[model samples]
Target: MVLTADSYRVLRGWVNGLGYSLDARLIPYLELAGFGSATLTQTFDLQYDLISALVERWRPETHTFHLPCGECTITLEDVALHFGLPIDGDVITGVSVIAEPAVLCYSLLGASPDDTDSTFSKLKFTWLKANFQHLSVNATEEESVCPARVYIMHIIRGVLMPNLNNNKVHLQYLPLLADLHNVRSYSWGSAVLAMLYHELCRTTKPDAVDLGGCLVLLQLWALYRIPFLASVSHQPYVFLLVNRWSIYPGIGRLYTVLIYRLMIEQHTEEGFIWMSYRRPEIAAIIPSSSYVDSQLWCTNAPIISFNIVEWYHGDRVLQQFGYIQYIPDLPMPVGDVHGINKRGKHGQHWRVTHQIFVAVWENRMA
Candidate 1:
């Protein structure tokens, strides 16, 4: 079974197309949760082929792309700078199997699905839109918080850490959003990266077709790092660098997936910009806020999100972080660990199930 370049292209339909109507009432909550930096000024489209090209280059064994230029993978710094999400903070883990999905929704989100299935932990995008998009004009502070939670839920379910269920959002994350004030404390960016890493690893199998993670992130990370793949951006620079590809057209959009695959294969080390973010012109636009805890961008730790655990190997790609590039040591052998997930092992707490990696994530001092 030969895995051709095209075999890796997993076709997907986006949930964000349901529309982004972030109510003005929710900005305060969004700002509180450190998500204010994520700008969704426009509803966007994704080229699955572009993402497929990058996946073809991804080496799940090392969790880095084996490009002609050298090993390069999306770093915590890229997640922090590009999306402005918190990278260094609490590990995002919780009960995957919510016993009472409807009750959980009603308690935190102020509403639940009309048709309640006892085993269902996922809510439809339309339900969230119908219940939360239009907050009451005279909504109380408490009432406002509910919609804010829903908005973040929509973002996560739609793009950030989406599953294969395009229309339905898993209700497991709703528990974490219970305290709107503390939402910022969780390392959402890390979890997002973890999910992407898992997706990259899964797609490497010849039979895998469906992908379930933030595709936008992988595509943007590639465009920003590879100077050749990035397009000329005339738009004024935005902090969360998603502006480059989200709202405006980029060079990758103009090329076919085959072209992108060929371009990546032909790429040489000189064409890769190891530290493009540190450029004077680029640095000038990024506000000081994004640099907080700049130390953790190179954390040599595991990026954990619930049952999913994937290694974040910043040491391997030191050059991308402005450090002198050296051939680093081998990737930690994660033998059967990468295959761990919340399948038949239902109703178990992630903290206990993934205790080993969670310990590494908890003691994230670096």
Candidate 2:
């Protein structure tokens, strides 16, 4: 059937609701995000198709593009360290672009071996620098960068100090608030969570890992700042959930559920609407090749990446979009173990059912 103007508009509206601005350029990326395949060749094509479309449409001549994480303060030293000595009154400190469900950045300074610990700082700096550019906070502006700093400072303060009368967490280190909004908190929080998760898997010490701590920290950051991500209907989390790792499915589910519960509780009506509409587009990012079933049973694959597919729906926003159900038992095929073993194909099949879920939320009006 021929695509109609109205139909095209509807689809375009669908894509924009996913987060891209309503423009022809974003169409290809929207399409790629929905394709599913189980082959490496297919994934490469999807990536290429979307990237090519963006490059062609935006036609960004400069090496740098606006970043989309958040605002922060970046010192002159930080800029120089990242991009080297000034070239023509400025140098490219970093480059950032949104890729599907997440923001990606490649910076010069943080690339150093010694700066491994500085990952979050670098990411935050890049996010702020990009946002500053977006807001036209040029170096020559009379208000200058200081005003911007103060602005972000206020936001950080507002988030951390929701109520001066009530003591929540220790806010003695108020200065760190600004740093937390950008990438620093997220990066460090992510790293800490990953390490803790790994430890949980390795040692089976869920009690010692403090899952709530990491979730609390991330939730606070996401709530107070990072509204863009917090606004998203689903947040992607990757973890191993295999028997060999001795990791229980419940451990993974708990963390995912915690994030959703806390985030939803914090959501304003606007946030809920934002998520409901965005769920489809975000859910569409699960590439066709990345099926949870195969990933679970696939051999020779690092179990981590496959697990990411499973946790994709744990959030409330996404969970609200869908439901999960578990079936306990089913009839087993009758056969002798030796006969089945000799055949090496199928003999007695044990009947078992796992959780089944669906996304039922309607897309918001565009």
Candidate 3:
């Protein structure tokens, strides 16, 4: 079962794609394993057997990697280490190599509070900084367009929020945001803003000063330039679905339907949009004729009413009363629950309820 030259080429391509060197070192391993003179099928079988043996010996499945904030997951970091690849540079950042167990404990649990000089913690911090720095910005003159700003805000609020820490990282990026604003690099500025929001949301016990700072920053951004909802793009809608947060509840559900029509039904080709969850339930609520409604759900009271009455009422009651046991039916046009008003056609009720449902479903899936 001699291996074909074509099979060798395919293996070479795979190794190169993984950022591994292909040289005499690989040749010896291949020949020693009988891959140098085997059929394509035989070569695959031999490689599978070798990988299985390595997996058994290494027990990578048993090793759990810890994140900076106490999250743990099984990862291939052990396998990467066993393969003698560099674990700290572009390799780790690009591939998202799991953190070593010790580093995770120190970063998340504060195992050694006084030891600020630990190598693993330093490495993790450096990796974080580098990854954010590497995010590409669209530096065109139209980068500050309304659609673009909304897109950037969605990315900040939804995608990057969970993994960031607000207290430490938000203030660190003030200068960068200021510089980007000065240069009119709205895309870059938006990225920094998103990072700040991400950190802000992660704050476990936010104090008055923290809330004030966040408010002030947000006000400044709002006043810097007015962002309109003109020229709706797919990115913001996709981010909204993926992050499951909407500026307005009606608007979010409207966007969900819009995304289904444009991306799923019409088959409009785009990146990022493909990765988002398709909310058919939302789409079902929207009338088919209103598929191209330029005003979105602003004037669609019936649909908006359907959204509130059908979906959000029960959750709103539970949130107020802590359980569904001692609650009255939600009054027409929802009322205030903890400063978030649910009444009115365009009130916070829609927004909050929609967010609650999205978060609940997302967490359940997770």
Best by lDDT: 1
lDDT of 3 by residue, 70-146 (tens): 11111111111111111111100011122343454333322322344433221232322322222135533332222
RMSD (Cα, Å) for all candidates, in order, is 6.3, 25.1, 27.0
TM-score of each: 0.87, 0.18, 0.16
Best by TM-score: 1
Please report, as a residue range, the 10-residue window in candidate 1 with the lowest summed lDDT: 232-241
TM-score of 3: 0.16
Runs with alpha carbons beyond 4 Å of true place in candidate 2: 1-143, 159-161, 165-174, 177-275, 278-318, 321-366
- State each model's CA lDDT, in order: 0.76, 0.22, 0.23
What TM-score does candidate 2 reach?
A: 0.18
For model 1, state the Cα shift of residue 353 in Å.
Answer: 0.5
The local lDDT score (0 to 100) that residue 276 gets in candidate 2 is 30
Worst 10 residues of 2 by lDDT: 10-19
Each prediction's number of clashing residue pairs: 0, 9, 6
